[model samples]
Target: MAHKFPRISFFQRWSILFKCIFHYGMIFWYG
Candidate 1:
């Protein structure tokens, strides 16, 4: 299935995961 997508798709998913982690970190710090 991974072979179906291009490298950019993988990078996009990685970026989204990073953003999600960052968002949770912000909430933990400021909540």
Candidate 2:
């Protein structure tokens, strides 16, 4: 599943990292 994406741009990579952080933060705060 993790290998399907093309890491061709810095913004895409940054956004993915940001999303992972945001999701973890939300779960930590709400769970």
Q: Rate the local accuracy (lDDT) of all candidates.
A: 0.94, 0.85
What TM-score do all the candidates reach, one by one? 0.72, 0.70
Where is the poorest 10-residue window by lDDT in model 1? 1-10
- Give the alpha carbon lDDT tens digit for every residue of 1-31 in model 1: 7688779798999999999999999999999
- Candidate 2: deviation at residue 3, Å? 18
Model 1 ranges with Cα > 4 A deviation = 1-5
Q: Against the true structure, candidate 2 has what lDDT? A: 0.85
Question: How many clashing pairs per prediction, in order?
Answer: 0, 0
